[model samples]
Target: MDHVQHLIDLLRDDLTAGRYRVDLVDGLWGDAAAAALFRGQTEPAVRALDAGRASGTPSTPVESFARLFLLGQALPIGEVAAAFPRLRVAGAEELGLVVPAGGDAGRMRAALDLRPYSFVDTLGAGSWWVVSDLGEAVLGRALDKDHVLGIGGASTTLSGLMIPTPVDSVLDLGTGCGIQAMHASRHARRVVATDISQRALDIARLNARLNGIESIEFRHGSLFEPVAGERFDRIVSNPPFVITPRVDGVPLYEYRDGGLVGDALVERVVREAADHLTPGGIAQLLGNWEYRAAPPGSEEGGSDGLERVRSWVESGGAELDAWVVERERQDAPSYAETWIRDGGTRPGTPEFAALYGAWLDDFDARGVREVGFGYVLLRRPAEGARATASAAPTPAMARYERVAEAVGSNPAGLGAHLEACLAGHDWQAHRDDDALLASTLVYASDVTEERHYWPGHDDPVVMTLRQGGGFARTAPLDTALAAFVGACDGDLSVRALCAALAEVLGVDESLLVADLLPAVRALVSDAFLLPAG
Candidate 1:
């Protein structure tokens, strides 16, 4: 038996013998530590190694101990796969290792695509390899592994950020593990998750049951074809928006890679989303877009990442609202090497270097410099705005909107700014369902409310209480502002009450309409607010 197989067997024996029950397994390495390791960091590995060395198990083989400790416990196959690194042996050979029968590389991948974090774990791999394991783990008899689904933060983030207004229908585009579909099932009357991989769809169905969520329809196909002519009140996707080439003969994972070159996956997804949305419906997604960097401003003024997204929203002849939050931008070679590491394809190997070089060459040919990747939230606007198209779609809108600049590198301040703005506007606390019914609301405490008005405007709009240091302040509101603010009892809205207040406040409502509205809409666009359509 090989060294790795022995270790695998020993762990299996330990699991079967009830040495580590499912609940206790997490105690060994907490989820955060396990998650860090699974995402390919050396800190946890080094710490675990030192801990093993200190435990008087010198030469007990640190890697073996780590694997043993990890696998011996009854962790789901998917989570285990993610924590498995690119190293050989890993002590799996210390005992007789039984290859789950008929398991090829795809099946062996269970150690990789075990959960939602698998996407980030494998994001460095330019090839789509982890999806197969996701299928096996999610569908495996463990939790009725009916669907091999790769679960991770992106999946959950997309799920959590979806506009949940109890819509009649929801469509999960590129539904890898069906996480989005499962979440949508909570509010939408009917839900469907689609992917090109039949394996993924199978796992999506299994996951639906595993999570005790029912009535989700799973379909096998690419993008919109599976749900042609199907319009939905909400559409959510954590699609294969990674701009990478689709390797042939490789069963596409359908979770992260869209099988296209450079930003096309996102463009296509955005282009097509309008067709699937009910009028005024919203589609929220996470996407990576390549922003072309030019000379001079290359370091400072790289094309705003949000512009391309705006173009996509407007292309469909839909009046639209788009919010693009650029999280990280990596250079071509750095990006290439990063993805290679993700695929478990070592950088030292000649073949791996060649593949990476090809990726760089592809970028150079396209005149692409740094790649911009982030979340995209788009809404189909109600009809009748001037049909004029701008030269630059995103930044122009962002500038015209007059949102406070992203403060510092953190952007944490951005949320605070948005909160203060909402708090300052007409904030009506609704007692019942009457839109016109006004009730006297006394401040239970002083409310230091803030309103986000056009940068130059004088009206206090969005109303949020700032309760700190044991002091409370109540900020007052106008009639229009009152109607807007009073409507926000965790429900959805078609238009922001603040925009109406801008009209009533008689501040350049047009500028307020253009600049502040997008930012206000962005809060809803990011799923931070109840659907206030």
Candidate 2:
């Protein structure tokens, strides 16, 4: 055991010696080539490396490793071994990172995909090596159903959205390559990462070990089954919630499809999350929810996606705070094409046509008009959860929004923004309308106002308060609300501000206060306005 541990430590040291970092990798092949390589186009990077070799530019250890693992190029054992002096070809073989090339003597091919990933979060900048199954681009064929995925857009989105508030323990369900579990370990004392695939668990464990992260414990089980009857301070999952048809000829990619017909897996995760969370614990996830075709003569609009998610949270019958944001919704056909192509079945192929037809047919059978994708933040209510049994329980927080435009950038990442918003919400939740009116509040620094005048009119046609960070929310403000927000400098109480605004606008103070209270609470939840310290 000690020898195996020492072997992995050597692998880590060798990778560090190779200068495996985002900046160095980008510098190796130039920006355009790097961009192309990330898009699964290897030609540009291959040409760059070939051109460099022709120009007498010696390959660095990172370039050699990238060529072998990332580009999936089979190189002479001598060349690959030279890059890792400590963990040479023999040691790499022992670690199962490489294998002898079939029928090609003295050469080896990568058995997996390993790459350097870097990010900036609340804990500052960090980097790590991620190992996963070889992609279709490397295999030159369709991916296997149980393929493990490397760091990608969804992975980065979830990690960036993870709140870094210090926690005792966290549960990372469906922890594919252990990306979220690794990130969770930064702020969490321990993390239990569970996945249905043993292969995924093995890879996740390798990732944790490769990064020198000791706090994560990888387990093999589907969803909450691994830690049944146990609870944690936090839970994070980017589950296989893809909407896949169960019919014949339609492929079920294990990395995306959870085998439970259309969004049922997402529903299950949301509902079951309640039982696995300790009091005050929060579960963050990314999921897809179907937007069903509304019933005839329905008064509600076309989309019921947000409401369905709310119902899932309520179905758990727990007092939980749920803030779900629908980042974007894709129509049925678009959604079908996106996932179909994701499995490496290109358009114009017979396989692609068949799968696409199956997806649409499945959607039609269930009356699914479109699919909504976004972030879900659910918190098992704090304070021993219903500790106020003797008193009236506070209403659980539920805020749903559909944000279609690009969200603003935050240096410390969205996690801090979300944490602050949730904190602000908690502070204001304890205060009633009467108490809220008596308290002081300050607007966030990322907020600004914009006024648009039509035809050079003295009165503005539209006034808007825009949040530069958080979710990049733009709140259209009426004259009274605009004045109210402008006066929120933490100087005066809410009552004083409302009175001052009413006096200026010639409106009754009582009505003004009543109208602005809800909007003020809204701004607080959006991190536009925060409780004054």
Error of 2 at 137 (Å): 1.8
Worst-scoring 10-residue span by lDDT in model 2: 384-393
Q: Which candidate is the best by lDDT?
A: 2
Per-residue lDDT over 1-533 for candidate 2, one digit per residue giving the tens place of the 0 to 100 score: 67767778888999998888888878778999888887888888888888888999887888888888878898888888888899888889988899999899889999999889888888789989999999877888888888999998999999989999999999999999999999999999999999999999988988888899999988888888999999999999999999999987777888899999888999999999999888888999999999998667787666589988999999887878999999989999999998887888889989888998999999988889999999999998776443332454567888888876677878656888899889878766776787888899888899999999989589999999988887788999999988888888899999999988889989898988888888888888778898888
**Candidate 2 deviant stretches above 4 angstroms:** 294-303, 384-393, 455-458
Colliding residue pairs in candidate 2: none
Q: State the lDDT of candidate 1 residue by residue for 1-533, as single tens digits.
A: 65443444444343333333333333445667667655644356456655755887633222333343333223233333433332222332222121222434333221323211111111121111112242221223212222243555566456545554567988888877676676677678899888888867765664554334667988888899999988888888887776664443222334556777778888998888877887667687878877676654366655555676666767766555565666667887888776655444566777676768777777776667777666676666434322223322222122112122232221111223222322222122111213312222222122234666768878655655333211122334444434453555533332344445566677765554454344334333222233322
Best model per TM-score: 2
True-structure RMSD, every candidate: 12.4, 2.5
